[model samples]
Target: MAIAALQHLTDPRLAGRIVLKIGSSLLVDGAGCARADWLRSIAGEIADLRAGGQEVVIVSSGAIALGAAKLGLDKGGRATLADAQAAASVGQIALASLWSRSLGTHGLTAAQLLLTLEDLEDRRRYLNAASTLARLLENGAVPVINENDSVATQEIRFGDNDRLAARVAQAARADAVLLLSDVDGLFDRNPAEAGARLVPVVQGIDQSIRAMADGGSASGLGSGGMVSKLQAAEIAERAGIALAIVNGTHRAPIARAAGEGQGTLFLPRRRDGARKAWLGGRLRVKGVVRVDGGCAAALAEGGSVLAAGITAVEGAFERGDLVEIRDPADGALARGLAEYRAEECRALIGRRSAEQAAVLGYAPRAAVVHRDHMVML
Candidate 1:
């Protein structure tokens, strides 16, 4: 596919929070050290954004690269899992210190958060992480997040910061996500290929779009390629968050991407009901609740689901886990964050608010699934 010309940028910074994923190639040098001057420049941009009342969250890569540089462990450009983890242990401290110092120069406080797949995948931990992020933003602190590579096994890791950024954006309910890459943007073919131009705006990613994805990082420092970025875009798209792929090698990458239309922005599904978007796009629904006709009618009209309306409960989900609301004929009707555990739900089946207290030996929340947390499918 031939790349289309650049369209006018939608001003992704128009409202709400933004997530920025910093690629290794952008932050780390070939010698495996942080680019101090470049970081200061990036921090200046962040300071400017913060002054404008726009919150920013960063998902930065380069721990392993920095570690490898420090340890001189680049054996044929590949290391054992143990060696990689050891490098990460040393690099994480170096990365965090550098981030803190750079942002501090601008009088901005940096909070380092090392996360693994479980932090975002587990319901309880997800909420905890979300709460912490919310508090940091509220207190005017910039969070510098990274994968816990030191402890994260290859099997249980996010491998690339691109998808992690999108997931963080979804969890943080950011209005937009920016993936700063080595190349200019999403190209029609390998960016190194001749006559390959940048695609300004992605309508939606399909198989053909997937075919256009490039291979792994040529620098051999980063794990992500254009393919991982598209996957990230897909995640952001489903979460109703516009995601942009822009070159981070520039001076003001964020400003350029959001204001000057300098990259390929994947348009969001819709921003009007982002909560609903997140709910609907959940990759895993821990349980299913079959609701009666009356409840279904109420839900369709944007009402909450009452315990009295629930006929059956399936799946051993915990409180706060996502669940599917179903009807016999309609199949899955909606998705919601459950207020009660599966066992408690079963005990409260067909019971009203008062009866629920007696059956479960405790007063239940007003709604089985609050309307605010439920999205009609």
Candidate 2:
């Protein structure tokens, strides 16, 4: 089984939709400039993948590094949020131009997308992003994605592109995620340590697996390290997407990683099983709604929760926030995204959908918790 899993990692044709995450350390030189030769080689690999009828998305990290270098802030010092943002603003243009020129050599168009954490957290924005990427893919354009660091503060930042790539994979419904890093693959311990061994296949992530990751960043120019990569793997696994971590210094790293088994492959759970697990997982429930017995029964029958059937609302929550549905007896029945804010939910409780506009001044949706968003416990 382990050998088969390794072979699956080496099969470049296994996935139709692929998300490649390039670390800053691999894309930037020690002097903090874009590695043009490396970019061109990777672009050539992408061209080959497209020729083979595969769609590719690139989640790259180098704006900050390039920006820092351009601004003379590459002296190995910690940069403030303002400095980082300034650097990102200056470097994003160069980064986009490099990717555009590299891919254009093979007659491919590169579409640049800048995103923040909120873009994926808000349901509406998430759908918008997904739709835009889908259209780009349909038109045969490679989406070159990067964090919106110019506007992101520490409180609202993704902190690393590794986690952002995982979110992108989920949003794009990618079949696999490839993380190109400085190391060859995941090691049982720090490779610098004596007797460290490579872990070729990972079926699950646990405390033991997490302990293997080093806390330090891979390079001075990058924010993520093995820890963030493991976090990314966990996110991808939950979405039933396979993730592979491999060395990026080699030529045609993507093809080699997929066709030579030169990395650690994290196996994904079955798609349906993963979805069910995600729905029932220990998500922080922000609010609770107590519904009538009729609504509880309807929920069990895969129906949405109607405002007229809700008897009470508890806790504060905004629209698109995860909330729990409970029976009149206060027993949990299901969980779903709230269509209305807590205050609006209070005003609309026990009211018909027609009365929503009168009470809230806007009738955005008819159901309090849409059936498509709700999951039975």
| Global fold similarity of model 1 (TM-score) | 0.72
- Top candidate by lDDT: 2
Tens-digit lDDT track for model 2 on 1-377?
32235345434567778898999888889888788888989999889888877799999999888888888874422368888898899889989999999999999999999999888766678779989999999999999999999999887788989888988988788888889998988999999999999999898887799999997776767898899899888777767788888999998887777677788988875453433434433235789999999999888888999999999999999998889999988877888889999998999899987788898887559699988877665
Name model 1 segments beyond 4 Å from true. Answer: 1-13, 75-78, 258-260, 271-377
In candidate 1, clashing pairs total: 0
Off by over 4 Å in 2: 1-13, 74-78, 272-320, 323-377
What does candidate 1's lDDT look like per residue over 1-377, in tens digits? Answer: 11122222223235458888898888988888788778888889888877777788999998888888888886412478887788889888998998899889889899999999878876677778888999999998999999998998877888889988988887787877878888888888887889998888888787788888986776677889988899888777767677888888888777666566677878865443645655665556789999999998888898988898999999999989999999857567888999988998888888877677778777679888999888876
Query: Which predicted model would earn the best TM-score?
Result: 2
* Residue pairs that clash (backbone atoms under 3 angstroms), model 2: none
All models, RMSD in angstroms: 6.9, 6.5
